[model samples]
Each structure stands twice: as structure tokens, then as C-alpha cells.
Target: MPSILLISDIHGNFPALQAICTQHPPEQFAHICNTGDCTVYAPYPNQTLDWLRTYQAISIRGNTDDKIIRLLKGQTFKKPGKKEKRIMYTSTAESLTSENSAYLLHLKKKQVLKLGSYSLGLFHGSPADHEEFLFDNTPEKRFQEIASTCKYDIIVTGHSHTPYHKIISGIHFINPGSVGRMFDGNPAASYAVLTIDEQARQKIQVQHFRCHYNTEEVVNELSRMKLPEIYGIMFKQGKKLN
Candidate 1:
């Protein structure tokens, strides 16, 4: 059996990422897989990317990552009311080191990993769309539609910042939820552990873990950066503040 540590939506909170990694080191798992959205909405984008690079995490680009890439290419979000977002994305892009920027630029939108005797499909969202949200409450018909089209035995996705494990038509879908931000009403950082055993009748086991990190530290860092206070509040509250 191989133990895989699954994480996603880090969003630049180095302290939270560090706490999770400290609790569950990459070396302890068969693989440390990140579902992306690694940057944005917090401080320490560079540190977050550096940590991912150091661990050589299996990662794919998410929607916010795409925004950073586009910002690097001189394409700014021109929407009238998104000044804060524009600033946030631009600042994150500007903070990226050359190596990290190149890493983001070359990332594939999706990846397929062959683990043990099973194949896992990894995506920021669903296999067909990078920005789609497949949450726990997503209609069964939609999931069935995806399962019918998906070729992999297990489908791993992020971008919803919500965690869930579902089996539909003999296919396993797992989302480890958010590492930096939690939108499920609980503020604790989230990750998932997956074990696959070919000999067992059950074959697979998925568990979600929540590790509490220092949210005050993240809030202080955000304040030091002079970014929007809404993000700090979100960090404190574990959900998007409207």
C-alpha cells in the first residue's frame, strides 16, 4: 500500500503549508501531490512556490496560477471593479522568482499519475475544465456525466476549496480541500491521505485531515503587505468574506 498526501489551494500561506508539511512530511508519503492555486490572496507566494519546488510536489496549474502567468505576460484584468484583485495578482506575479515563474509557465493544465497498479487523474478542477467546481453537493447527474467520460479509476481535483471523497460508477473522486484557505466553514487547514491496496477487497481508503495553523501570523503578514483586509478576514474566518 502506498500512502499519498494530497493538498491544494495553498494560496500563499507559508505558515499553514509549513504546518501541514511538518505534520506529514513529503518523505513519509509515496507522493506529495498538489492540485494547484498555489498563489494569491496571501503573503509569501515565493515561499510557497519554493516549498513546492523543494519537495518536487506533483502539481498542476490552477485558475489563479493562470492569472499570474497572464499578468506576467502584461495582460491585466481590465474589469472595472476588480482593482484589488488586479493588484493582488500583479503583486504575486511580480514576487515570483525567475525559476518559479518558469515553473508556473510550463505547468500542464492536467496530469495523469500511475500509482501502484492504479491510475489517478489529477486536475485543478475536472478533467474537461480547469476552472470548474465539483463540490460535495454537485448534482449526481453531473458527476455521473464526468465519470462516464473519465478514463482514470480515480479522479483528483481542487479549485473548489472544499474536500470530498465520492465513488460513482466504480470511480473514486477525491479533493483534499484547501491548504491555505478553507471555505467549508471550518478554519483549520485541510489535506487528504489516500492508500491503495490491490489485494484488499476495499482496494482504496481516503481520509481528510485538518491541521490548525497560526492564522494570526498569516493575518499579520497580510497586514504588513498592505493588501486588502478582506483576505485577512477570510483567513481568520476560513471563508470568503463578501
Candidate 2:
């Protein structure tokens, strides 16, 4: 059996990602897959990107990444209307260096990977759209339809920042949640591990895990950077502090 790590929505919190990586080193896994939103919302955009590059993790472009790319190209995909979103976008965009921006711009939007005997579809959101969200509470019928339409035996996604594993239409769907900014009332980082049992009939096992990091460090950095105070509040409370 071989194990693969599934991570997503890093949101520029390097400490969180580092903590998760420390617990499950890259050498222990056959492959590492990131579902996107690799940068933004916290400090350390450059460091987070550097970490991902060092690990050679398979990554897909997330909506946040797309926004950064659009900014770099002097374009706008969607205007940030809300105050918090505007601050988040602006702060993250300004923090990224030209080199980091280029790396993000080149990230693929989707990936179909062959992991051992399993064919996996990786995306930031649903297969049909990158901005769409597929959460744990999504309707099974709808998930089944999406599963049937895709060519993969398993679909791995992120963006809702919630972790789940479900079988729909005989296809497995997993979301490893957010590695940086978690919104489920827990400040701990979230991720998943997929184990492929070559000798077993079932063939796959999904395990979700959370790692604790120094949230105060991120919060203090956010404050030091003069990003909106709400960002720090959200990091501390694990929800919108408004």
C-alpha cells in the first residue's frame, strides 16, 4: 500500500502548512496533491509558495490564485465589493513578489493524476467550474451527477474549507479542507491522507487530520502588516470576527 497526502486552501499561512508537513513528511507519502488557494489571507505568501515548490507538490489553480494572476496581468475577474474581501485581496497581492506571482500564474487549473491504480481528478472546486463549491453538505444526487460525468474513479476537491469523504455513483469524492484558514470553529490546520491498498479489494482508504500551529504568530504578522484587524480575528476565532 502507498499513501498520498491531500491538502488545500493554504491561504499563505506558512506555519500551518509547516506543521502539517512536519507531522506527515513528504518522504512518507508517494505523492502530495494540493487543491489550490495556495496563497492569500495571511502572511508568508512567498514562503508558502517556496515550500510547495520545494516539495514538488502537484497543484491546481484555485480561485484565489486566479485572482492573484489576474491582478498581476492588470485584470479583474470579479470586483471585490466587500471591505474584508477587498483588504484580503489587496494585501495578498501586494505581498507577493514578481517571482511568486509568476509561479502562481503558471499553475494548472485542473489535473488528472494516476496514483498507483487509482485515477484521481484534482480541482479547486467542482469539475465544471473553479469557483463552484462542493461541501460536505452538498446534495448526494448532485454529487452523483458530477461523479458520473467525470472520468475519474475518485475526485479530490477543496475551497469550502471543510473536510469530507463520500462515495457517489461508485466514485469516491474527498475534500481535504483548508491547511491555513479553517472556518469550522477549529483553528487547527486541516488535510487528508489517501492510502491505496494494492492487495485489497476496496483499494482505498481516506483519513482526515488536523494539525495545530502557532496561530498567534500568523495573527501578529497580520497585525504587523497592517492588514485588516478582522483577518487576525478570524484566525484566532476560526470564523469571521465581525
Candidate 3:
């Protein structure tokens, strides 16, 4: 049996990623995949991207990543929403290095990976829409609709910052949650490990892990960068503000 690590919504919190690596190193997994949002909303954007590149994790473009790409290209929506404005104007976007910018630009919107006898569909959000919210409690009809659109044994997604696993129409759907900014009222960093046994008709096992890191250190880094103080509050509270 080999294990795969699924991570998403890094949001540039390097310490959280560091803690995850410390607990679940690359050697323990067959492959490490990221659902994206590698930057924005916290400090250490460059460091986070560097780590992802170094690990060579299979990744896809996230909504935050899309915003960065648009900013790099000097493009904006006709009527920018508050979230769009916040993401485009974040210090993290300003600090992204050219090398990392190129890295983000090359990311695909979705990835389908073949692992042994199983096929996995990976996306930042849903297969049809990258910004859509698909959570644990999403209606069964909605899952069925998504299922009708894609063919895969398992579908993995993120962007809601919530972790969940469910079987809809005999397909396994899992969200690994947020690696950096978690909104589940838990301050710990979150990720998931998936084990597939090729011998047992590709039996799947999913485990979610939460690693505690030094929140004060991250807060101090954000303060030093002179970013929004609300970000610091969000990190401490482990919930989104507004």
C-alpha cells in the first residue's frame, strides 16, 4: 500500500507547512499533491512557493493563484468584488518573485492522475468551476450533478478551508481543507493522507492531520511586514473575518 498526501490553500503560512513536513515527510508518501492557493493572505509567499517547487508536488491553479496571475498580467475584473480587491492588493502578491510568478502561471486549472488502478481528479474547487464552494454538507443532488460531469474513482478538492470526505454515486470525494488559514475554529494546520491498496481493488483510506505550529511567530512576521492587522487576528482566531 502506498500513501498520497493532499494539501491545499497554503496561503503563504510557511510555518504551518514546515510543521506538516516535519510530521509527514515526503519519504512517507508515494506522491504529494497540492490543490493550490499557494500564496496570498499571510507572510512568506516566496518561501512557500519555493518549498512547493522543491518538493515537486503535483499542483493545480487556485483562485488566489488566478488573482496573482491576473495582477501580474495587469488584468482585473470589470467590477471587482471585495475579495478580489483584497487578494489583488495584498502584500503577498506584491512580494511574489518573478520566478514564482512564472511557476504560478504554468499551473493547470485541473489535473487527472492515474495511480495504480485508480483515477484521481484534482481541482482547487469543483471540476466545472474553480471558485465554487463544495463542502461536506453540499447537497447530494449537487454532488450527483458534479459526478455527471467527470469520470474518476476519486475527486479531491479544496478552497472552502473545510475538510470532509463523502461518497457520492460510488465516487469518493474528499477535501483536504486549508494548509495555512483554517476556518474550522481550530488553530492547527490541516492536511490529509490517502492510502490506496492496489491489491484490494484499490481500496482507499483517508486520514486528516492537524499540526500545531508557533502562531506568535507567524503573527510577528505578518506584523513586521506591515500587512493588515486583521490577518493577524484571523490567524489567532482560526476563523475568517467578514
Candidate 4:
């Protein structure tokens, strides 16, 4: 079967990242497409980068990832609140390691790949804005606007931190949500394994894979390290804490 591993907003939670791999296993995907933000929030920056490197996923730069890279370049970062400060410190401090800094700095912004019969465009936010968040509540008119500028059988976007799929005018738009920082009430570091094919008669079929991870492990790790932003509570509830 032709398959794609769609992930985003890993945010440094290594256990959830591990759980995703353990559940799907690398053997399952034809390709792993990450929509960025792999280096903040949680406590496993290097580990997260290592896993992505293992697959050498087609990654696009996220807004958060951009900020991390900026810090690595010794550029001044915006003053974050207490929670945001924790994220800044972790990402900045952990990334001082040359490997992490260089890796993040060199990540590509976006790409379009052909998967069998489908054209898949990978981007962190909208094609127009890498950080422009299109949420479930985004107006349909905006969706129409996004559809107008991008051409692909499927458009894969992350940043809203929600897993959703909706087909408009024959274009399939998908957000795999946060692979390591889900706010889906159960906090399993949600992601999607999408299997699409033309229906025998003539149409597309989509299957959404929503999996749950061990929230306690994430919470425990957060508490153990005292990571910033009280992110643990949000993940536990499966929604954005900040």
C-alpha cells in the first residue's frame, strides 16, 4: 500500500515521538513528511532531531523551528513569558551542540513529492505563510483562498495542532496535528497515517489514523525536568495549555 507518515509540532517530546515510531514502525511508510516545529516545548530536542534524521524526513521549517534556528545563529529572540522562556532556554541551550544547530539551520522550507498517483505538497503552515495557522474554525472562504494558490492532489499542513481532513473542490487538505504535542483530550501526541486511493467507481477515499500515547510519561518527563509553560497539563488534556 502507498502510505505517508504525516507529523508536526513534535516540540521535543521524545517519548511520544518514540511511541509514534513504535506504533507505525518505519517499515510502514513510503516517506515521512514532517511539517516542522520539531525542536521546542518538550524536553527531547536532540532525540527528536535524531529520529527525523534517521528517516531524513521531508521537513518544512515551522515558525517555532525558525525561532530556534534564529537563536542558534546568535540572533536575539523575542522575550517570551515564563512558559515561553522555558521553551526558549531548552531549545537554545540544547541546540548549542553543533550538530543540532547545523541540522536545524539547514532544514528545507517545503517540498512537493509525487507518491504513486498523488501529488503531495508539504508545508508547515499555508503555502502563502509558513506559520499561518488554518484551524478547524477557519472560515470556508479562507479555505477556498488557500486552495486557489496551491496545486496538489493533497496539501499537508501543520501548525493548528489539530488533526483534520476535508476535501474541497477535489483537493484533499490534511493536518496530522501535533505528533508529540497533541491537545486531543487524551494527549497521545496525535498524528495521522493517510491512505488515499481512487475509489473503483471514481472518487478518493481517506483513512485517518488517530493514536494515543502515554500522557503520564510526557507529564512525568515534563515534571522531572520542570520544562516550561506547564505544557504537561495541556498535553494531558490534549489541548494547548498556553
Q: Considering only N, C-alpha and C atoms within 3 Å, which residue pairs clash in candidate 2?
A: none
Please identify model 3 stretches exceeding 4 Å from their true place: 77-90
Error of 1 at 2 (Å): 1.2
CA error at residue 206 for candidate 4, angstroms: 3.2
Output candidate 1 Cα RMSD: 1.3
Give the per-residue lDDT digits (tens) of candidate 2, residues 30-137: 889999999878889999998888888999889888888887888875566777677777777877878778888889989999877679999999898888888999
Model 1, range 102-205, lDDT digits (tens) per residue? 88888888888998878999999898799899999999888899999989999999999889999998899999999999986777899999999999998999
lDDT (0 to 1) per candidate: 0.89, 0.88, 0.86, 0.77
Model 3, residue 60: distance off in Å is 0.7
Off by over 4 Å in 1: 79-81
For model 4, the superposed segments whose C-alpha errors exceed 4 Å read 79-96, 196-204
**Residue 54's C-alpha lDDT in candidate 3?**
86
Q: Which scores better on lDDT, 2 or 4?
A: 2
Model 3: colliding residue pairs: none
Candidates sorted on lDDT, descending:
1, 2, 3, 4
Best by lDDT: 1
